[model samples]
Target: MSTVLQPGPARRKAARIAVLSGIASVAVALAGCGDSGTPDASQPTPEASAGPSAAAAELVVQDPWVKAADDGMTAVFGVLVNDTTADVTITSVTTDISPVELHEMAMSDGAMVMREKDGGIVVPAGGSHTLEPGGDHIMLMDIARPVQPGDEIALTLTFADGATSEFTAVAKPFAGAEESYDPSTEMDHG
Candidate 1:
């Protein structure tokens, strides 16, 4: 004989409420915590070394980082701010971590699908494009080395106008990403 355990209406309501409350808590935390703080002495991130390029005076990069990955693929998250009159295209990204490409994630058929992005990412004039988890992001294909917490990864970004800016992204452990994306991957912003 088998037993049928059915949840009562009250029990179901309680479960739903619990789930919603948890979600709300996380939303609040992510919103309130702000950008990943500056890198520690064990590792230094881009925020430590440089400012916006002289050529792209109006272009700014902020809160750049990659999730910790020992190997395989990973992703980078950050914000591109463009206050200039000309739209700047991120033509290419180079890093010691791995070969990188512009990628986008979208919902397809009730599941998340990721694909290579064409034409690169554009920081619109007077606006910005954000690269975050579960959205448009930088894919570091096949992380060639051990990228662990308290490590720094060098990144170089080249723009459409033949301008380039170097970045240093700190490898930090992140939670809650496995719920929306592969745990092996990566974050972003305004």
Candidate 2:
């Protein structure tokens, strides 16, 4: 009878398994170390990127900013670009400050007139609405802390379709707004 060699050990199989496990671990580590993708600055963040109560919309907020103010109030300026084929309406604005309102400035009686935007600002299809000083913008009022240059202001823009977009406006010292209108005409939007 031919001499048969008994199975010596499971060492070979165990070694193969160990090598596979090491490869899997290295793969996982590399995946975790990969670089995060870059984002487009023009568009608003997705729901996952933004927090709860935020949804995606066609409007893009570009170069948003809040001018520095002494203490009482300030304004956020930016351009709202609606890239959709249909018109988009921005219903309201909210911020970290106590009171925030959507405002519009226009020349009414040969003088600059500013007031709270009643219904909402409408952005035509494939058009852009500029929220600038002496124009349409978000008014941040009743702020206890003085807004200084390089500060950041958090704000949310609500739409008529129930979608909300969040953005942060950087504070900069601008001078054009001082001569735009009389500061005493500000009224309560309550």
lDDT of candidate 2 at residue 122, scale 0 to 100 = 88
TM-score of each: 0.62, 0.65
Choose the strongest candidate by lDDT: 2
Error of 1 at 38 (Å): 45
- Please list the C-alpha lDDT of all candidates, in the order they appear: 0.74, 0.75
> Which candidate number would show the highest TM-score if scored against the true structure?
2
Taking the candidates one at a time, how many backbone clashes does each contain?
Answer: 0, 0
Model 2 residue 80 CA deviation in Å? 0.5
Residue 135 displacement (Å), model 2: 0.9
Tens-digit lDDT track for model 2 on 75-153?
Answer: 8889998766667788888876748878887665566567788888888777998998777888876776888999888
For model 1, residues 10-99, the per-residue Cα lDDT tens digits are 999999999999999999888765655654466545553233343254567788888887777778888988876667788789997588
Which ranges of candidate 1 are over 4 A from the true structure?
1-58, 179-190
Cα error of candidate 2 at position 101, Å: 1.0
